[model samples]
Target chain A: MVAHPTRDRRAERREATRAEILDAAWELARIHGLAGISLREVARRIGIQPPTLYWYFDSKNAIYDAMFAEANRQLLQLIAEQEWPTEPREMLRMAARVWVAFSTEDVARYQLMFQRSIPDFEPSPEAYAVALEILQTMRVDFAAAGISDPAHLDLWTAVVAGLAAQQTSNQPGGDRWLRLTDEAADMFADHVLGTTTQESQR
Target chain B: MVAHPTRDRRAERREATRAEILDAAWELARIHGLAGISLREVARRIGIQPPTLYWYFDSKNAIYDAMFAEANRQLLQLIAEQEWPTEPREMLRMAARVWVAFSTEDVARYQLMFQRSIPDFEPSPEAYAVALEILQTMRVDFAAAGISDPAHLDLWTAVVAGLAAQQTSNQPGGDRWLRLTDEAADMFADHVLGTTTQESQR
Candidate 1:
């Protein structure tokens, strides 16, 4: 594909506008609940007519899809940035900490990415693919620790995601739930790996 | 306090109307999301003027509070009705199965009771007290199994609730996530109670 200089500049500007729109939507979602986000408010915040949003997003769900994809991409980037521990148990604990922190820090993003709370908004296949990739990465990580069962994977997600849920719902901005990340991870490791926490630590 | 016959009848009638309103709200919530529930629609469904609803519920949030209390009360009844197994491990697994079934069967109630998805609707102290009772019951049951640690309780709730969340969000009306409930219970019991599935079974 040949990119004309004029077209490339236009594409860059379009991308920037799209990013700005997502930013506004997120701000509104944070203030109001995710279900409370209005395209009109998003446009107003950006100093544009509500109808102008259609040029960038077909509908509110489209904006949510983009946000969904963006959130997962951010997660993937965060995972990449981490220097993962070599030992499987320590690695799981590290992953759990990262997840709880990531989820509780910005609850609106957490709800969009994890809770499926938004009415009638299913993440597009493109966006959902990113989520699947994150799971695939988790699978590989678990397999490295000699834990590859599908049921085990489900249990692991529940334990970690549960911690995130508890933290976000029961005590936002508090470490009461997040502080259990290591114990939860170790419990999971012990169950799936058939080793005790002391053994894993050793 | 002595109860007058006329006042008792009036109280009974009011209680009946309140139940009807909650039923309508749940129906709407099932069709629409929890956040989508409207007092006007709920009133319309039960063939009452919008203002009449305010008589029963001071506000939309008040209706949500009643529903929250109702859901937890239902859970408590279900717990009481169950013929609990004598073995602590079996009892825990049984509790997990019961929770997954109850939660996944009604996504709206699950969101209201668990997800905290409703904007500006905090469960009243009266409603939240019921939830605390359920947790206390769980504490007693776990204690019977000699798994009395606070961290263990958090881990247990996370594991079971995770299964329910996965089933509801990923596979509503499917047992894909629910099927892992027993395994998850065992995994948790193993971690906290120091008992393997094989030993637990015996």
Candidate 2:
């Protein structure tokens, strides 16, 4: 098939507009609560008529789905970019640090991706697949440490996310909870890895 | 001061109205997101003019504060009412069950109490004091298990809150995360208490 230059340019522009709409929605979410996003307001901010906004996103929930996928992709990129250590325990700790930093930096994004703050917004399957991929990536890290139980993965997520939630919720712009990241990862890691004797001293 | 029966009756009615307003707000939150609540909508629900709502709550955030305090008080009551096991480890596990149940039962309440979902809503000092008291009560439990380190308490909270967050966010009305409550609690418990050999086998 021959490449159509004009159609390619048009598609590029459309994709850019979608990104703009998503960025504007995130800005509104930061100001209003996540669920507080109004489509009319979003349209107004992006200099589009309220009805015209539908061309890009059919509904507010559609916008949410895009944002969900975008956030997860950023997470995927972050994980991919890290020079992950070969030592499994160190890798787990590094993952915790990366997640906490990512979550606390943009609380609105964190709530959207992790916290179910939006009442009716469930990520579309395509978007949710990205989240599952992130989990699978972490699963391999846990498996490397000889912690193969699925329950431990659930526990690992709870611990690290709890740290992020605490940091974002209680001590925003502070490290009270963020500072606990390494220790928390080590604690859970040691617990599941059956190496508790040394860590118990802490 | 001398008791005034008529004044006391008037005060009782005023308090009753306040409770009614809070209940209405909670109803709205269940339907809408927690931060999606509106002062006007609340007034309409309870058959009062929007302006009249000021008598009970000076602002929407005030209603949120009242709700925050009320939610924590309920948590405090829930903890107080538990038939806490004398065995520290048993008590800890029991506490996890209670918390995850309390949290997943009503996600709106959990978000208000635990999650900073409402961007600008900060609980009043009195309300936060109740939250702190809940933490202090749990501290006694950790202390009983000979886990005197405060970091352990933070880890325990992260672990448990993570479970609640997981249950409420990922598997609402499902036991996927809820079923992990005892194991999650025990993982952290044994990690801090130095009893990992038995649990790691799982």
Candidate 3:
């Protein structure tokens, strides 16, 4: 059966409105800390009644889920689009830099994804899948480097993400942690990765 | 000069009250997220009106500052009370475990010191000095370990703090990162610390 033209046009309009609301929420979240934004303020910014927002979003948590999913989608695209180096160490180094850069780019998004900023909020399964996909990408990279152990994966994430956390928390746009990114990548590649079968193979 | 008996008694009472207020605030912070507590709630818990709280803490951020200072003092004490291994690598392994344990033990304190949870809340110079003192102790340990460069210090902080963060945020009470603490400490000792002169001295 052919889709009805009016129904399709109406669907497009609904999608456009949802996108507009999300954009406004993110803009406010950037200024206020991630937990600072409220549904009322988001609605006021977009000149919509709060109830109208409820029509699109079940609650503030739903909006958070959408935003989280969107952030991951952007990250997935960023990773896919980058020209990665072939050498395993170089690639991990590049990955570490990108991970920190992505996190620091928006403090709010970084908090939402990495931090339990919102009380009583858990990402919906569909939204969480996006996050899982991002983790999967990292796992694949680790596998490529001949490191498949979950413990190693956990340690690498802790090291890489820890630098980003320090950079964003202590000194944004500063070289304190950012300068060490390359050095750190080298350290992990030499120190941590050496324990892995990958470097042992070399 | 020797203090008068009356003045000494009054000073003791004041200090006692201040400690009581701070304790109540921390109890509430643990229940709510670190940033979630209000002065009113703290006052109510301690059976005082909110205005009375101002006698001890000038404002909410002042309370946060006190809390931050208290947390660091505890850290300083914790470090001092422990007997450290003489072996450089063993000391680092112990240090890594202690750091993660300290951080996860009190999530509220961790957020205040490291995560930047409170908006517009900068720790007062006095409170921050305590923090600096804590860092200075870490520096002394690093020096003893023969890892004197600021780069090594930065990397070490990232790795230790990063694991604490993952443990608290992703898997509190689970050993995903905690279990790797020994192995990670070894990795740092072998790779990063081995590059230092202290390890060579061994």
- Compare the candidates by lDDT and give the number of the best one: 1
Q: Can you write out model 1's per-residue Cα lDDT over B167-187, one digit (the tens) per residue?
A: 787778898888888888877
Better-scoring candidate (DockQ), 1 or 3: 3
lDDT tens readout by residue for model 2, A85-187: 8766787889889998999899889989988877778899999999999988878876876678887788888888888877777777888888889988888
Candidate 2, which segments miss by more than 4 Å at Cα? A1-3, A36-52, A196-202, B1-3, B39-51, B83-86, B196-202
Sorting all predicted structures by TM-score, with the top scorer first, yields 3, 1, 2
Model 3 misplacement above 4 A: A1-3, A195-202, B1-3, B195-202
Give the lDDT of residue A90 in candidate 2: 84
Segments of candidate 1 deviating more than 4 angstroms = A1-3, A196-202, B1-7, B196-202
Error of 1 at A42 (Å): 1.9
Give residue A194's error in model 1 in angstroms.
Answer: 1.7
DockQ, cand. 2:
0.58
Report the candidate with higher DockQ, 2 versus 3. Answer: 3
lDDT of 1 by residue, A1-202 (tens): 9755656777788999999999999999898978889988999999999999999988889999999999999998899899998788889899988888899889999999988888799998999999989988888887887778887787777777788887788778888778888988888877776665457566
